[model samples]
Target chain A: MKAKVIVKLKEGVLDPQGQAIQQLLAQRGYSQIADVRVGKLVEFELENVTPIEGEAMLAEIADKLLANPIIESYRIESQ
Target chain B: MSIAVITFPGSNCDRDCLHVLQNVIGAPARFVFHKETDLGDCTGVLVPGGFSYGDYLRAGALAKISPIMPAIHRFADAGGPVLGICNGFQILCEVGLLPGALMLNRNLRFISRWVDLRVENSDTLFTRHLWQDQIVRMPIAHAEGNFTVEPETIAKIVAKQQIVFKYAGPVREDSPDGNPNGSTLSIAGIVNEAGNVMGMMPHPDRASEAILGSTDGIPIFRAFAEAAQEKSRLEYSY
Candidate 1:
C-alpha cells in the first residue's frame, strides 16, 4: 500500500512563497494570475499494512514528524 | 531559575539567549540541542531566532518537525513557560503551539533593523514586568515576518486579550510604508490560548544588555523568571 500526505498551510494563514510567485508571474506579463498557495506532498510505501494500521501509523507520523499542526494541516490518502 | 535555550541547526541567537539568561540575568541556563527530547529540569525554554534549517522549504517549515518538538509540546502542555523569538516565533507558529502564520514581508524584502514595539498586554508571563503601552526598541531580522490570520479569529484574539505586542507609533500603524512586513493588525507578538507560551518576531535577547545599546529587554526575561519562581513556590507549597 502507498500513502500520500498533502500538507498545506491552513486557510487564512499567509503564504509568502505563494505570494512571491504570484508577483513574479504578474511581472512577467502573466496578468491573469488570481492566487497561489504552496503546499508539500509526501508519499510513503508500506507493505502488509491494513487501512486501520496505516491510519494509526500515519497519525503518529503527523504528531511526531510530518506536520507542525500549528500552522499547517495535512491529509492522508491511500492509492 | 533554570532556563534552556533550544539550539537548532543554523540557530545563530542561541548563544545570545543563553548569555542573557546566565550572565546578565544571573539565571542558570543551558543550551539544548534540537535532537534532545528531554528538557531536563528547566523552568523556562527559550527558542532563539535565526535561519533554522537554513529557512529552507519555509521560514520554519523543516525545523518545526525536529525531534525535540514533541517535548516542546509536552512542555507547553505542562504549563511551562516558553518564549520563541524571531525565527523561533515562526517555528512556534509552524508547530501549532501559537496561532497565526508568518508570511513574507509585505515590502518583499529582508528586514534587519531595530523597531519600536508597544507592549499590548502586561499580564502575560513574558510581559508582566512591563507597563501596559510601554515602548521598547528591539531588532527584527527576517524575510518572512508578516503575521496573518482570519478576521474572525483576530476579533477573538482581541476579545481574549491574547495580543501581547504590536508595532507601535506611526511607523507601525501606517501600513506598507510604516510597517516592516505588512503584518495584519500590526501584530508583532502574541501569547497562546493558555497564556503560558509566547511567540514574537522581535529579538528581545538582543536587547537584554546595556552593551547592546538597550536594556529594555530585561523586564521580559525577568518576568519569565519571576513567574516561573512563583509557580515553583506554589507547587512546593502543595
Candidate 2:
C-alpha cells in the first residue's frame, strides 16, 4: 500500500518562497491570485497493514518525523 | 578537561571547532563521530555547523535523530554545557530541545558575512564573560536562520531572559543591514531554561581568532571552559 503526507507551514509562519512566486506571477500579469503557500508532499509505501492501521501508522510517522510540530503540520492519506 | 565536538556526516566546521577549542583556547578537545553512543569523559559538548545529512527534509532535521543525540541530551540534562552553532542550532530546535524553528531568510538567500551581535543576557554560563548589551562581531553563514516561535513562547523567552544574542542596530528603520536574516526579534542566539544548552546561528568557532577578523568569539569558549572546569571539579572532588 502507498501512503502520502502533506506537510505545510502553520498559518502564521511566513512563507517567503510562496510570496516570491506570487510576485513573479503578478509581474507576468497574473494579478488575480490573492496569495500563495508552499508545501511538500511525501509519498511512501508500507506493507502488511490494513487500511485503518495504515492511517494510524501514517499519522504516527507524520507526527514524529514527517512534520515539525513547531512550524509545520501534516495530514496523512492512504491509497 | 576535554570538550567533545560531534561531527555528523557533511559537517564542515567540526575541525574548526576542534582547532579553536583545543589550540586557540588551550583547552583539551576531541572529535566524536555522530554515530558513537558515548561522549567519553568530555565535560562540554560542541555541535558545529554544516549541511548535516545534506540538509535533507530540513536543515539539521535528519541529524537530530542521530544515535549520539540521546547521550548529548543526557549530558545537557545533567547541567553539561552544550553549545550548538549554526546548523547545530537548527538541530537543537529540530530535536525539540530548544523552542521555535529556523525558517528561510526573508529574502531567501544564503548569507555569509560578519554581523554585530548585541549580547542580550550575560548571566548564563555561555555569556558570563560578556556584559549585557555589548556588541560583538561574529560571522554568520546560513540560508535558513530566521528564528520563529509563537507569541506565547516568545513571551516566555523574554520573561525568562533566554535570549543570549540579538542583531544590533535598527532592522526596520533606515539601516536594515545589521540583521542578515529575518530572525524574530532579531534573535541570533538563545539558551534553554536551565541555561546549560545554547543554540546560536552565528559561527563563533570561525571567529575565535584575530586572524579571522574578530576575537569576540573567544569569550564564549572561555566562559564554557570555565564552567566546564567548575563542573568537573565538583564531580571529581565529591
Give the candidate number with the greatest TM-score: 2
Q: Which pairs of residues collide in model 2? A: none
Each predicted complex: what DockQ?
0.31, 0.75
Which pairs clash (backbone N, Cα, C closer than 3 Å) in model 1? A70-B96
Superposed Cα deviation of residue B166, candidate 1 (Å): 0.2
Q: How would you encode candidate 2's per-residue C-alpha lDDT over B1-238 as one tens digit per residue?
A: 6889999998999999999988888888899999999787888889899999999899988887799998888888788888999999999998877899899998899988778899999999999999989999888899999999999999999999999999885454433766778889989999999999999999889889988899999999989877777777246311
Error of 1 at A78 (Å): 7.4
- Candidate 2: residue B237 Cα off by (Å): 16
- Candidate 2 docking class: medium
lDDT of 2: 0.88
lDDT tens digits, residue span A1-79, model 2 = 8988999999988899999999999999999987999999999898998989989988987886778888899888777
Worst window of 10 by summed lDDT in candidate 1 chain B: B229-238
Q: Could you tell me the TM-score of candidate 2?
A: 0.95
